[model samples]
Target: MSKQFAFTAEQLKSFRENGYAGPFDAYDQNEMKETYKKLRAEIFDRSHAIYDLEHSSLLAGYDRHLDIDFFSRHIMRRQILDKVEGILGPNLLCWRSEMFPKYPGDEGTDWHQADTFGHASGAPQVVWPMNTDFGGAITVWTAVTDADKENGCLRFIPGTHEEMHYDETKEMKYSPEQVNKLEKNGMKSGFFGYDYRNLQKDPSWVPDDANAVSMEMKAGQFVIFWSTLMHASWPNTSSNRTRLGFTARYVPTSVRIYPDTDVINEYGSKLSLDKYGVVLVSGQDEYKHNRRLLKNARGLEFATALDELETA
Candidate 1:
């Protein structure tokens, strides 16, 4: 496998310290634009989508990589997998992917961290081994369109991944009516339909935005970060431009995904995991804790470095 996009020693060191790394180049501007155009066309065609939900539902964007060939290939890209392997080891599995679109006048995402990813749903979505107390997926977020402060760029607080500020077990009321209406520290933000502040360990404490750094990226650039990092985004304050981001969440093969849950209930929608399966993007899965898929819903096989080597 080519090590062209693998994280350097310095980059890995910085990632270990800061809990995040890179707005690395994945696709050129023209390629990204063309991909975006094709994605727009395919997004509405939910024939192969795993979830049966209305297009307007917030949960509609979940796990498209399972059905979309482009996304299936995207999650297996060397640029992304190599960096993820550097952190999570060679045995990697992509369990989830979500589409984040910030239309004009849309409120920014609330500042929050997800360890078990159960803030919205009452049950834990992912659980690490009993030996490890720390658990959170590595998220690779790619900018599908140009993102800036005006168009809702991502913001992160470095070195915040180790500690848990919010309790995932805490129940957060989903209130879609409150979207774009709530303001925090003079900034308009909300966690999709739910208020993330409800899950805070300390109800009186607030995030220190003074230390937060904005990640403004060009089209096709991707950033890797821990899912436990305290992160959010700016409101899309632009008159017309909309910010689009795609995030793929990865964890080592040993982690148990969706333990004891066949149905996912979040964002006021319910989804059955009957067709859900994690993609083994790199290496081998000896633990086999979760269902693994070799091909996407479109019948296109997911290519990995090992697969390429065997074929070559």
Candidate 2:
């Protein structure tokens, strides 16, 4: 797989050691922070409430980041997007991005899986000839507030991304309801009833030895990694601070779209993979319709903005 990308020997080696790298601080830091402050106000607003999933003080995937103005375009910058093409080649899709905010005392555990919820499709790449170039999809997350152990930073297992998955079976999966309970109540609610293969010792999903590390980036810094990276976060325990973040996912053109017919939003329309560029990126003439992204991307680029940030 390393041969497929242009990453130097060091990057390939480090990726093998940590599964991912660089909460790349590519943009101007002050602008990044200012942008996030504005977005946060919009996300937590009680009225719009489209992003508030804490039905009763728990589970808040609401007011998700995709609807935000700054991040969507920022995530697709050529400086960043070009690297995917450099590594995985032309034609790409914005699979999905997430707002994985770990607020103070907001305890939750995101189960590890290669693709979005174990592949939007029900099959694995090993059993079927389904080659999921999406697993290599890049997700960039910038911390709006400083994130550390006290505020539930992310944890990752080294070299795990290179390993093959165990055979999929009912004995090794969690139900939607069960995962909900875990989020609403915390891991103390209990572990998933299924048998997870290649299990490790870290509750955060990183390994027990030097194989694990917490992502303690500053407010303006961010990290980007493949979807298959083994990662998780802890309960936020700070006094009165909230850890906010904006994240997005990008994939090379070779991946297939796992179209979903499920209707999730108030619009009652089917949220298919088509809504994303996946339907476009995977096609032979993908860029024939690529104007949508190129049009919206006017002046975005990676520049000295990150240097103005207060590194502490």
Candidate 3:
């Protein structure tokens, strides 16, 4: 019998053709509202957070699954893993999670594609086995608040994941002042502080937005897509709404996480990996290339992989 939450054959076919999939339900609206309130409080108190940075730091949102109880559980939810298991097989590891928040009038995220995720850091954060032509993590982005174009919802260009439009090895200069100052074809957007267009393989190229699709998800819902997909978001034009998104990145256990790296220097900040470890959300890890943490700093044990739990 098929596993619960597993994608149907038709859905798998659509995912293959479109290079992305659903805004599936992960939480109820009322539940999300209450959970978000608690999350906000926990987010600000980072005494036990993996990184030894201030709460106000730009990279403060890097990985709270290591310390926060809610995030630890959220990352391992069966609802997310069941669907992710469909694309990545059963063996998987959650290598990273990040918070993306856009306030009213904030600039949109620039069109970008991340395969190795080295465009800014100058080192491939994740590496697949040799001879593989393509390598990219599957990103599950969940909306912590209602997301709409008026509040900077995500945009995706279908069927673009198979191609590499940008060279991630290229370096992009980080400039915080340029956040809301840049405009792409009259669209207000910028990649955090860096201009993502700097890493484009073709300087004269521009993503054809005519074929792009806006993904507006309600709070507590999630959309899954390839990190290599041509994706971006629109500027928040709302008067007071804030769009919050939490992204959890997953990859097969065979892949190497932060190959031979102890520190990550990106987004104008250098973060040490002394407390960083990958969480195995599903199946087993045979390669053992990365450190695996079985629990959060709060002594809360992570939920075992669905298959593992079912068998045990």
Candidate 4:
């Protein structure tokens, strides 16, 4: 089953150890730009999602219903699904999807895990838009525009995916609460500057080497990563040009949705997955995609394998 494009044992090992993968370029830029321009105006409404200024959570937020728009409605469209099936396996379900845009000079987002809102199911947070083999949600981060360190690209930690999340006493949902919580826990927000202002830095953190290497992708490149990969974005210090990226999550059917608790805030959010007119992967799907993906997928760390790469 291992194909040339499938993930290598070393790549899998790295993903297992590092918690994240890729700076790999997944698609052509010109076409992606064209597709992005169309989808942005059509699906996302070109409107900024209002946030809970204090907590930063989306107030009302964008809908994850794929049926609302053509672009979103087909999250498992062949091109993407084929690749996903290759990685995670046949049985799959969507976790959620959202548009993330960092306006010029904007402080992107904070470093955090995805499941602060729920409990760990197979492995929570590490599933996939591709396949959640690692138990975390798989997120396909498609960049609509250039994502560089200057305009706030993503940062990830290696080898931190296995850490279970509990006692998130600091995962506050409002600004005041977050501030108070940070103060009480003695956490600092001083690592980088957002719009020229230094913000708070997290106390306990992720894989130490995650940020030392990062993706500087041009518009159109999509980076697929695990939700458990401790990831963050840099502040957009550029006076112009915005950074636009969106993420979609895919989960395996085997993992159950964690029951809702007030601790998560979403009152009655059930997996409610049956709602998708057609389940992308009806628990019955073989998840053959994981093996398929394993066959072709290459790990970023494997770049060191080629003697030419080292000498160049």
Candidate 5:
């Protein structure tokens, strides 16, 4: 890993205190725009996608890195891996990647935090070892388009990653018809198809947004944060602009992903795990608790952090 891309001591301290870090540059604006054009077309082609679903479904955005060449390389970029290594140590596994697009008049995402990532499926998706103190994955969110308040940029309440505000074991009813029709605190918001408030530890409690910080970023910039942080987004009020984000989730090799599960049931869709596997982004996986994919679905071998360093 290049020392130039690694987080400095001051930045690491801030990450620990704020539960998030950076809007660091990854690609130039023109490069991102060109990549976005290709991504839009590649995303629509689901012939090789692991999950069988329509483009209209929210679950259609899940795990494209396993099939798309761009995403496969995007998840392994040395610029990203170096920063992620600073937080999660040397060995890392990218278990999940999702595409988030907010069009005009789209409702903002609900204020929620994911620990086990089972608020909708009613089953734990990722489980840390019993001896570990943390439970959530380190999520690296990259802006595929310019993201701002008008285009549904992300919002975060600092220092909230340590506590669980919402219980994942709690069931949240998924209603596809209710999407983009719900409102919270006068702002249009909803959690895909389900109301995230349903999983709140305290039903009457509401998220205090006074201290929330907006993470506005230009295209190609990325931020890293714990999945347990209290976070949400502003509604895309623009008439023509769209906000798009790509999130790659990482955890230490010791973590077990999708323990005791074969199929994923969420967002009114069912996906088979027969072809699903996590990518080893950095170092060696000594614990091998989850299935590992040496290459993408298209047969292109993934370039690991170790591979990049050796070649450099």
Candidate 6:
């Protein structure tokens, strides 16, 4: 039997080999433009946000989907989950979401992969069963604006997800002063404020740029990729354009998010997970290892359709 909106066998084959897929359309251009305007304004008002930090805090982008109505709905959209379900099975949970904004003159994201997601925080953010060799979320990144090479679109090294090149247990120093000052192979890129290269298992092993593909996407389109993929972005060389990406991360219900932590420390800031809860996007959570919520911090309902789909 086949599933609607699920990836075709050919596409799944490609995803397995390339570690990424699509520039799929999730919203109409005009609709996205209007939504972008609203989101731009709404993002500045974090009065009802789950995190108790200022709007301009670096960690402010942590989980807007938990409070913003549009983001809340976006995470549960069938267009995205349908494809995600093809890989993660039916019982899925959106454990985290974050905003990546690259403005004019901003450095591109450094090439990196995340498994346990402990490189920066010194604590694992996501964990899988001991028997499983793989552990990472499926990140669906939506382009809020045109993402072209000149405007800092994402890039990936094909087939790199199976083998991790970096050690997540390594420590990285956060130095805001090194933001635009460091360059890798003459490319202007850095992972937030820290150098992602610091976590590399082999300090001398460089990424294969010859196999790197630029993922330029139009506004309202999205791409799905494994969080364990070797991904990076180009610097926004455009004089005026800003590239914005809304990343929603998903994992099977069996995976544990923030395993045993109440506080998160990363990106030179710390946040308490006092109100954090995983939004179940599809199927029922049989494991119940993580906290689940049905509503946002602002009282907006996080609609689910588990009963309407097959459970894993």
Write one digit per residue (lDDT tens) for candidate 6, span 105-224: 999998999998888899999999889977899999999998999999999998999999999888899887788888877778888788889898999998887989999999999999
- lDDT per residue as tens, model 4, 1-312: 334344666866665567655654555788767877676556434232212222333312233333334334345444455455556766666546666777775564555555422322222232233353345577777676899988888877665556644333232222333321121123232212211111113334332542455667887666766676666676677899788776767766654433222122331222332222213432343443321110101122111123234565
Instruction: Quote the lDDT for 117 in model 3.
Output: 85
Any runs in candidate 1 off by more than 4 Å, and if so which?
305-312
> For model 4, how big is the CA root-mean-square deviation?
11.7
Overall local distance difference test of candidate 6:
0.89
| Model 1 C-alpha lDDT per residue in residues 56-149, reported as the tens digit of each score | 6678789999888889889988888888889999998999999999999999998999999988889999999998956999999999999999
Q: TM-score for all predictions?
A: 0.96, 0.64, 0.96, 0.62, 0.96, 0.95
lDDT of 3: 0.89
How well is each residue in 203-276 modelled by candidate 2, as lDDT tens digits? 34433335566788787777766656766666677877777766656655444434333223211122322223
Q: Weakest 10 consecutive residues, lDDT, candidate 4? A: 291-300
Per-residue lDDT over 1-312 for candidate 3, one digit per residue giving the tens place of the 0 to 100 score = 468888999999999899899899999988998999999999889889888763253588888888989889999887898999999999899999999999999999999999998888999998999998768999999999999989999999999999999999987898977878899788788988898888889999978889999999999999999999999999999999999999999999999989988998887778899988999988789999999887788888777734465688
Best candidate (score: lDDT): 5
**Clashing residue pairs found in predicted model 6:** none
Backbone clash numbers for all candidates listed: 0, 10, 0, 40, 0, 0
Query: How displaced is residue 207 in candidate 2, in Å?
Result: 6.3
| Model 6, TM vs. native | 0.95
List candidate 6 segments past 4 Å from native: 1-3, 54-57, 305-312
Model 1, C-alpha of 99: deviation from truth (Å): 0.1
- Model 2 alpha-carbon drift over 4 Å, by segment: 1-9, 44-66, 108-111, 119-136, 164-210, 260-312
| Residue 244 lDDT in candidate 3 | 93
